[model samples]
Target: MTNVIFTVGNDMRADDGAGPFLAALLEADPAAGWEVIDGGASPENHTHRIRALSPKRVVIVDAADMGLAPGEVRRIDEDCVARHFLITTHAIPLNFLIDSLRETVPEIVFLGIQPREIVFMAPMTDDVRRGVAALHRTLVDGVGIDSFPGIAE
Candidate 1:
């Protein structure tokens, strides 16, 4: 049994790159019981990957414009991800995909970083960078880690 974390985002949009950025970090420390997926720009299309892995608990990280101050952090559950997380991956929105995966992946969780700037292809803000660093530490410590049968698939 192992856990999987899916970092989803668009690299062009500054802080929106949180997911992929974290994925890069996690990929470095790939010991036993860890799986990192950088589902960049197109998470919905990666249904096969999710299904294939079938993690017990999946943590989806992203930057969302949640009307909060820059660098604010909010942990969203599966049901609420569509309402808060703002991603420019594809025509089909996150909410749509979340709803579709609800029955299939009832244990998915969301970790959102409130981004002050979503400017195209920009670098991440200092605040978001620090917050991501903090989150990276937490994940490394297994703050949200859990066991799943197919996570290693």
Candidate 2:
């Protein structure tokens, strides 16, 4: 099974950029099997790209407004994501896309990093940066990708 992950967010927006930054970090790691996509705060634009890959496991990383304490990272399922975050684009809502696709695709999951602020033209806040780092550690050192097969080494 092909393992794929998509990072969608606007790097210009403080905490919102966490997604793209994490994507960059994952891309830099050769052992992490993922497709880094700069969704730029909108996932709609990348729907086609995802369709082309047709991965078995699809993980969408983004900054969400779950109303939790800022910088909190949560791995939300499809049912909860829409209620928490608007899920603007990132290729036609993974659930909807999956329904539309006749061919069997991959399992889709969402990992949302709570963003303190999504304001324009600002760098990442310290809390958001720390959050991403901590979250990455979970997926890397903790889960170790090895347990996930294609996701790690």
User: Using lDDT as the measure, which candidate wins?
Assistant: 1
How many angstroms is residue 15 displaced in model 1 relative to the true structure, after the best TM-score fit? Answer: 1.0
lDDT of each: 0.69, 0.66
- In candidate 2, what are the lDDT values of residues 19-86, reduced to their tens digit? 88887776666325556565566565666777787777767778877666777777675676665574
Residue pairs with backbone atoms closer than 3 Å in model 1 (clashes): 12-121
Candidate 2 backbone collisions, by pair: 9-41, 43-89, 43-90, 43-91, 44-89, 44-90, 47-91
lDDT of prediction 2: 0.66
Expressed as tens digits, the lDDT of each residue in 1-153 for candidate 1 is 446677778878888887788788778765346688887888887766776776676667778766666766676655555654575655577777666656566576667777777778799888888877767777677654322111100
Give the C-alpha miss distance for residue 139 in model 2, angstroms.
2.8
Runs with alpha carbons beyond 4 Å of true place in candidate 1: 84-89, 145-153
Model 1, global lDDT: 0.69
Q: TM-score of model 1 relative to the true fold?
A: 0.81
Tell me, by TM-score, which candidate is best. 1
